[model samples]
Target: MSTEVAQNTLSSLLEAVQPPNGGRNIHDPATGELVARAPEHGTEELDAAVAAARAAQAAWAARSHGERSEFLNRAADAIEASAEALAELLSREQGKPLNGPNARFEVGACASWLRATAALDLQPEVLVDDATSHAELHYRPLGVIGAIGPWNWPMMISVWQLAPSLRMGNTVVMKPSEYTPLSVLALAAVINTELPDGVLTVVSGGREVGERLAAHPGIDKVMFTGSTATGKAIIRSSADTVKRLTLELGGNDAGIVLEDADPRAIAEDLFWGAFINTGQTCAALKRLYVPESIYDEVCDALVEVARLMPMGNGLDENNVLGPLQNKAQFDIVARLVDEARAAGARVLIGGNPVDDQPGYFYPTTLVADIANDNSLVVEEQFGPALPIIRYSTLDDAIAMANGLDVGLGASVWSSDPAQARQVAARIQAGSVWINKHGAIDPRVPFGGTKQSGYGLEFGVDGLKALGAPQVIS
Candidate 1:
C-alpha cells in the first residue's frame, strides 16, 4: 500500500477504537508526543468479547483444517497490505526505530508467523492399529483462547499466540499491554479484515480486565507473554477454572565467550543479541561471562560496535536504538546502571543518559569488571545495558551463567562447535545457541525452564498447545 493509503487505514482504525468521550491517551515514547487514544475496556466489554468468541468457536472448529488455513493465509495478506502503516504506528508508540530490525521487522514478522502457522502440517496420529481394532489421536479446538501479549514486540507476539489458536479452530480474545495498546489494537484491526466476525477481538484495558479474563469460565486456555510476577498471578487466577495455560515469562539470559573465540568476529552479533529492541527483549542477553584471557579484548570489540550505532527518535532512519517504551523501564535501566557504577564497575561506553533529552532515552551502556552478584548482573535489566563479568576458569564461567534462577536462554561462543555443544549441554536454559543468542525461529520450539516459565511456543508443538487431545477407536 502507498504511504498515504496506509496512513488513512491507521487513522480509520484509531478512530474506530476511540471512545466517544475519549479514552486513554497514548504518547510517543521517543518524543513524548500524543500518538492516539486507546479504548479503556473493562470486565463488561471483556465478557461480551468472550461471549462472542465462544459463540463463534463451534462453527470455526467445525470447518476443515484446509478451510481454516486458507483464512489464516488471507489474514497474512491483509497484514502485509497494511505493513507500512502498522510499522509507522508501532515505531511511534513503542519507541522502536522504523528501519532496521525494529518496527518494520516486527510488522513483517507478524505476517510471516501467520503464514508459517497456516502452513504447518497437523495430521491425526495413528496411535494404535490392530487387525480387528484401530485407534487414532486427534487434536480439537479448546473453545475460546485468551492471549495476553507484552509491549516489547506487541504485534508480532500477538500473532505468535493468535495465529496458532485460530488455526487450531479456536477464537481468540486478546488483552494487550497497557503501555502499547494502540499497536495491538491497530494490528487486530488489520487482521480482522480477513477474519469472520468475532473470530478475533482485542480488549485494551488495565490489569483487572486481564485478571478477569484469565479466570473467566468462557476462556478454556490462556497464553501469556510478560513478566514472571504477572505470570504467577495468572496461574493463581486461572486455578479456579482449571484453565490450561502457556506462559513465556521473564528471561535473564546469559552469554559466555570461550577462551578460543575470536572477539572481533563475534562482537557485532553479541552486541545486537543483547541490545535488540533496545534491550527490552526478555531473551536478550542480560549477563556476559568472559574468560580472563580475552576479557578485555571482548569488551573492547563490543564497545567499538556499540559506539557506531546511533540512538535518537524512532522516525529517524539513521538511528537504530530508541528510548525505553515507558518511564518505569527507563528508571529500571538507569537505576541498575547507577548501582553498577557505584559498585566500582567500569563503564565502557554510553552509561550516562543525556539529561536534556526529551524522552526516556537511556544510552546504550556496557559495564565490565562487575561481580556476578551485582544487581545489574543478577537482575533482568530489560534495556540497553549489558553487564560483562570476568571468570578465571571455564567451570567458573559455566557456574556463573547457571547461577540465576531464571534460564530462558543462554549462548556459548567458541571457535569449536564441539566444545560449544559440550558447554551448552551443561547449561540449564530451555534453548541454548552454539554461537548466537536469542536467534529464535518460528519453526523451532521456544520456551523457558525454572522460573522463566514453561510450555513450548512455536512449530507443531505450539499448534497442539492450543488444542485438546482426544483418542478415538
Candidate 2:
C-alpha cells in the first residue's frame, strides 16, 4: 500500500479509539514528555474483543491451510510496507536504536515469521494403525490465546505469538506492555484489515487488564514474556483453569572468556551482547566470568571499545546505546550500579545515568571484582551494565557461570573449538554460543529453564505450543 493510503487507513481505524479505561499518555523517551495518547479499552471493550475472538475461532480453524496461509502472507506484506513508520514509532516509544540492525531486523523478522507460519500445516491427522483398529493423532487450536508481550521487542514478540496461534487456527487477544504499546498497535492496524475483524485483537491497558485476562476463565492459553515474578503470578492465576502457558521470563545470562580466547575479539562481542538495547534483553549477556589470566586485558579492551560508542536518542544513527524505556528501568539500573560499587566492585567504565537527557539514559557500565552474591552479579540488571567476576580455573568459571537461577542463554569464548563446545554443553542455559552472543535463528527453539520459565517460543517446538495433539482410533 502507498504511504498516503496506509496513513489514511490507520487514521480511520484509530478514529473512534479513545485511550483502555479512557485514554493513556505515551511518552517519547528522548524528551520524557507525553507525545501521544492511546485509548484504553475498558471492561466492556475487553469483553467484546474476547467474545469476538471466541466467536471467530471455529470458522478460522475450519479454513483450509492454504486459505489461512494467504491471510498470513497478506499480514506480512502489510507489516513490511509499514516498516519505516513502525520502526520510528517503536524506537521513540521503546527506547531502542532505530537505525541499528536490531530494529530493522525486528521489523523484517515479523514478516518472515508470518510467511513461515503460513507455510506450516499444523492439523489433526492419523498417526498409528493396528490389525484390528486404527489410531490417529490430531492437532487442534486452543480457543482464545491471551498473549502478554514485553516492551523490549514489542512488535516482533507480538507477531511471535500471533503467527503460530493463527496458523494453527487459534484467535489471539494480545496485550503489549504499556511502556511500548504504539508499535504493536500500529502493527495491529496494518494487519487487522487483512484478517477477520476479530481474529487478532490488541487490548491496551496496564497490569489490571493483564491480570484480568490471565485469570479470565475464557482464555485457553496464556503466553507471557516479562519478568520472572510476573510469570509466577500469571502461572498462579491460570492454575484454576489449567490454562496452557508459554512463559519467557528474565535471564541473568553469563559470558565466559576462556584463557585461550582473544581478549580484543571477545571484548567487542561482550560489549554488544550486554549493552545492545541498553541491555534490556532477557537473553542479553549480563554477567561475565573471565579467566584470571586475561581478566585485566578483557576489562581494558571493553573500556576502550565502549568509550568510542555514542549514547543518545535512538533516532540518532550514531548512538549505539539508547535510554531506558521508562522510570522503573532507570531506577533499577541506577540502584544496581550504586550497590555494586558499594560492594567493592570496581567501576571500569560508565556507571551513572546521563543527567542532561530527558529520557532514562544510563551510561554503558562495566564493573570488575564483582562477587557472585552481589545484586549486580546475581540479579538480571536488564540495563547497559556488565559485571565481571574473575576465576582461576575452567571448572571454577563454569561453576560460577551456572550459579545463577536463570538459564535462558549464555556464551563461552575460546580459541579451542573442542574446549569451547565442552564448556557450552555444561552451561545450564537453553542456548550457548561458543564464540558469539545473542545469536538466534527462527529454526532453533529458544526458551529458558528454572526460574527463567518454561516452554519454547520458536522453531517446531513453537508450533506445538499453539495446538494440541489428538489421537483417534
Candidate 3:
C-alpha cells in the first residue's frame, strides 16, 4: 500500500473504533499521547459475541477445509493490503517501534502466519486399512473459540490463536488485552471484512467479561496467552464446563553461553533475543548463564551493543525500542531492577529510568555480576533489564538455567553445532534454539513444558488443538 493510502486506512480504522462519545481511553506508552479510545465492552457485549459465533460455527464448519482455506487466503490478502496501517496503529498502541522486529515485522508476521496456516494440510489418518476393518481419525471444529490475547505482540499472537482455529472451521470470539484492544479490534475488523459475519468477533472487555467468556457454555474452547496467574484462573473457570484450552503463558526463559562461544560474535543476537519489544516478550531470554571464563567478555559485548540501540518514541523511525505497555509492568521492571541494584549487582549499562520522561520509558538495563538467587535473575522481569549470571561448569550453568519454574523457551550458544544441540536438549523448555532464542516460525509447533502452560500451538498440532478428534470405523 502507498503511504497516503496506508495513512488513510489507519485514520479510518482509528475513527471507527473510537466513537467520539464513549469507551476507555488508551495512550501511547512511548509518548503518553492519547492514541484512541477502545470500546469498553462488558459481559453483555461478550455474551452477544459468543452467541453470534455459536450461530455461525456450524455453517462455517460445514464448508470443506479447502473452502475455508480459500477464505483464509483472502483474509491474508486483506491483511497485506492494510499491513502498513495496522503496523502504524500497532506501534502507537503497543509501544513498539516501526523499525526492526517490532511493529511492522509483527504486522507482516500476522499476514505470513495466516497464509502459512491456510497452506497447511491436516488430512485424516488411516488407523487400519485391512479388508475386514478400516478406521480413520478425523478432526471436526469445536464450535466457538474464546481467544484471549496479551498486550505484547498483540496482533501476531492473536493471529497465532485465531488463524488455525478459523482454518479448522471454528468461529472465534476474541478478547484482547485491556492494554491493547484497538490493535486487535482493527485487525479483526480487517479480517471480518473477508469472513462471514459472526464468524469472528472482538469483545474488548475487562476481567469480568473474560471470566464469563471462559465459563460460558457457548464457548467450546479457550485459547489464552498471558501471565501464568491468569492462565490458572482460566483453567479453573473452564474446568466446570470442561472447555478445551490452549494456553501460552508466562515464561522466565534462560540463555546459556558455553566457554567455547565467542562473546563478540554472539553478542548481537543475544541482545536482540533479550531486548526485543523492549524485553516484554513472554519467551524472551530473561536470564543469561555464561561461563566464568568469558562472563566479563560477554557482559562487555552486550553493554557495547545495548548502548548503541536507540530507545525513544515509537513514531520515530530511528528508535527501535519503546516503553513498557503499562504502568503496572513498568513498576514491576523498575522494582526488580532496583532490588537487583540494592543487592550489589553490577550495572554495566543502564539501571535508571529518567524521572522526567513523560512515558513509561525504562532505559535498557544490563545487570551483570549477579548471583543466581538474585531477584532479577530468578524472577520474570519481562522488561528491558537482563541479568547475566556467572557459573563455573557447564553442568552448573545448565542446572541454573533449568532451576526456574517457568520454562517457555531457552537457548544454548556455542561454536559447535553438535555441542549446542546437546546442551539445548538438556534445557527444560517447550522450545529450545541451538544458537538462537525466541526465533519462532509458523510451521513449527510451540508450547511450554512446566508452569509455562500446556497445549501445543502452531503447525498441524495447533490446528488439531482447535478441533475435536474422532475415529471412524
lDDT of 1 by residue, 271-388 (tens): 9999999999999988999999999999999999999999999999999999999999999999999999999999999888988879999999999999999999988999999999
**Candidate 2 lDDT over residue span 342-416, tens digit each:** 988899988966676577888889999988889988888898889999998889888988887889999989999
Whichever of 1 and 2 has more lDDT, that candidate is: 1
Question: Highest lDDT among the candidates is held by which one?
Answer: 1
Point out where model 1 deviates above 4 Å. Answer: 1-8
Which pairs clash in model 1? Answer: none
Task: Write down the worst ten-residue block by lDDT for model 3.
Answer: 1-10
CA-RMSD of model 2 = 2.6
Residue 374 in model 3: lDDT: 91
Q: Kindly give the number of clashing pairs for every candidate.
A: 0, 12, 0
Give the winner by lDDT: 2 or 3. Answer: 3
Off by over 4 Å in 2: 1-22, 121-134
Cα shift from native, residue 454, model 1 (Å) = 0.9
Which TM-score value belongs to model 1? Answer: 0.97
lDDT of model number 3: 0.91
